[model samples]
Target: MEFQELINSPGLWLASSVMVIAVVIQAFVFLRAALAEARKVGMSRERYIGGLRSAVITAIGPSFSPVIVLLSLIAVIGAPTAWMRLNDIGAARTELAMVSLSSALVHGEVGTASFGVEAFTYALWGMALNNMGWILVSLFCVHRMSKIVERLYAKYNPAWIRLLMSGTIIGLFAYLLSGQITSPMLHGQYGKLCAGFVSAVTMLIITRLLAKYQRMQELALGLAMLAGMLTAQATFG
Candidate 1:
């Protein structure tokens, strides 16, 4: 059998759906728990539901960030494997790299050379092993990390600690944005920089100028991403 046929078989799709189904189930369970807690804390249903709507909208924009690389993954690894790996924790690029590395182990090249069933099987094992490592570490370390955070909060001023934690998240996003915006500049291109700039401006406008519109505020991130992507496409494409 050809590699593509095996990778994208109906059985593979059914198998890959396991992760997607698990994610859906977890989402529903968490949503129910959150609603229960909201009732216990005397939060009105309207307010909590609004927050949920906003969170979902906010998530939609960042989810699109993976689409370009996701297409490449689908092309090289076939849709079912790509679907499963993407639904897992590993980044799309990292998963693609693992496939390449694993295929190399069996002397097969992806999308070019004779990467048959054997190489594909090895690639599956490689991604599974790589993801297992992350799962194991999270299993062992999450509680410890939570405890450390709790102790730090107890030891330090709560306000300052909150700010520090906020700063850490901000720093992480700043690094990610800088990489996207500046990398292309090194190659004399400004598409990513333009997109990032447009997105930031859109966010500021939504938050500051349109503060009275609660719905818009909730959708600020998604709107900003759309505006940025459109702007970049018009300017660069």
Candidate 2:
């Protein structure tokens, strides 16, 4: 069968949906268990609810970029593959890179007339194999990581530990931002720099102006990201 004919086949959709459903079920189960534990620990209901609200709010901004990437993937791959991968361990950038590499290895390229069933199949396998290492490491090392953190807490001041963690997060973000801001390929593109600067300023403004508003505090990240996106569109789109 032609690759195009198979891209959105019912069989593929069924297989992918099953995995996505399993992930969603697991998430709900974990959430329920967390809420139960929170109640058992004498945590205040309002505080627990507020934490949940904050999590949802903060997740919105980070999720938007991934969703945009997923939409693009749907056009290149298919609905089933894109949905399943993004729903599972697939990161948009990583998945795209893997797919392109797989295609190249097979002497083809995605969206080109030469790319066919064989290339697509190889890309799927590449995505699956590449992600397995990270998944396995996480499964094996998560508990060990928790133990290390516990030991750190026992040995050091909690405030200092928190500062260290915050610094680590800031450093990681700075590293990512620096690549985009300084890349030779992006030297003439002001969109990325403009977006980053707008987002940072918006976040600072929201943090300072909405300091006393708990509900607004939860929404600060999303609002900042929206401001960044709008600025990028106005400047470059």
Candidate 3:
């Protein structure tokens, strides 16, 4: 059968559905464990429920972008592969990049006639293999990470450790943002810059204004993202 035919087969659909069901079960298990721990730690049930509701609300806004990307992937690949990859890794951009690289290696590109069965198969293998390293490393390192943290705390003041953590987070975000802001490809596209700036400003304003409101503070990030998207559309679209 052709790659497209194979990807959309009933067998593939069943496999993908099983994987998704497993993820759902894992999520429920973790949630149940966390709630039990929270109760043991004397957290109020109402407060715990409120936090979960706020998290759901916040997640809904950011999830739309990934859903849009998933739709695009479904057109390029097929429903089964798209659903499995998206659900398993939850990183559309990384998955798309790996698929593109695989296609290029096979002398084809996605969404074109040259992307045949061989290219599709190559892309599938690439996606599956590329993410394995991170998973393996995390599986091994997660337990050891606590030891590393303890060493750091023992060697440094608690305040210094906090500062280091905050600085690392800020530096990482700045690095990512700088690439977009300074990219030669985006030199002429001021809309993206404007949107980023607007988003940052919106976040700061919301944080300051909603400092006393716990629920509103939780929504700040989502609202800022929405504002940025709207500003970009108005300016560029």
Candidate 4:
């Protein structure tokens, strides 16, 4: 079967549905637990209901952050797989990275014509395995997290702990971004270089210049991505 055909096949969709279903069920379970806890805390039904409504409203803007990238994922992978992965991990980029790494096992470049069923299968396994690592780590390590945090705070200054957390987030994105920009630089892909630079600048402008606008801040990442993609297309095409 053709790569696209196999990816969108009934069997693939059925397989993907299992994960999506699990995520939905998990969400309901968590919601139930939270509501129960809210009652235990003596939160009135009216207040909790109001809070839920406010939260739902607040979530709308941030929820759109993934949509542009989600469409890209849907285009490269099939809708079912993309939906499953997004629901499972809630991070489009991470899932795409896993797919790219996995597809490379079959000498396939993601979204390229060279990709086939073998590459697709490899990607499936890669994403599953990647998620398994998180599950296993949580199963073993999560219970110890509180003690670990207590020990860290006991040993290190609280200010330094905060700095460490902030630095860790910054370092994660830096690593992901370096992988992207490094390949383009080495391959003389100036269009990609332009895209990255433009995106970075756009992000800074939105975050710094338009800092007063809360909605714009929420949309910053998506706006930057659109700006970058458009710039690259215009410059390269």
Cα TM-score per model: 0.92, 0.85, 0.85, 0.62
RMSD of 1: 1.7
Model 3: per-residue Cα lDDT over 1-237, one tens digit each: 976788788998997788689789999999999999999999999899988987887888866779889998998878998998898863898889988999899897988988888888888888879867777888999989988988999999989998998999999999988877778345677766777888999999888966888778778878888898799889886
The order by descending TM-score is 1, 2, 3, 4
Compose the digit string of candidate 4's lDDT tens values, residues 108-188: 888788777788889889999999988898889988997897788889999998898799999999998888788878987
Provide the lowest-lDDT 10-residue window in model 3: 184-193
Tens-digit lDDT string for candidate 1 (61-95) = 78887999989888888899898898888998899
* True-structure RMSD for candidate 2: 2.6
With a 3 Å backbone cut-off (N, CA, C), the pairs that clash in candidate 4 are none
Give the per-residue Cα lDDT of candidate 4 at 213.
77
Model 2 lDDT per residue over 1-237, tens place: 667769889999997798789899999999999999999999999889988998898887777668888888888889899989987886788999999999888887877876788788888888989889888999999999999988998999999998988999999998998987777345687887888889999999888977888788788888888999799889887
Best by TM-score: 1
**Ten residues in a row with the worst lDDT in model 2?**
180-189
The 10-residue segment of model 1 with minimum total lDDT is: 108-117
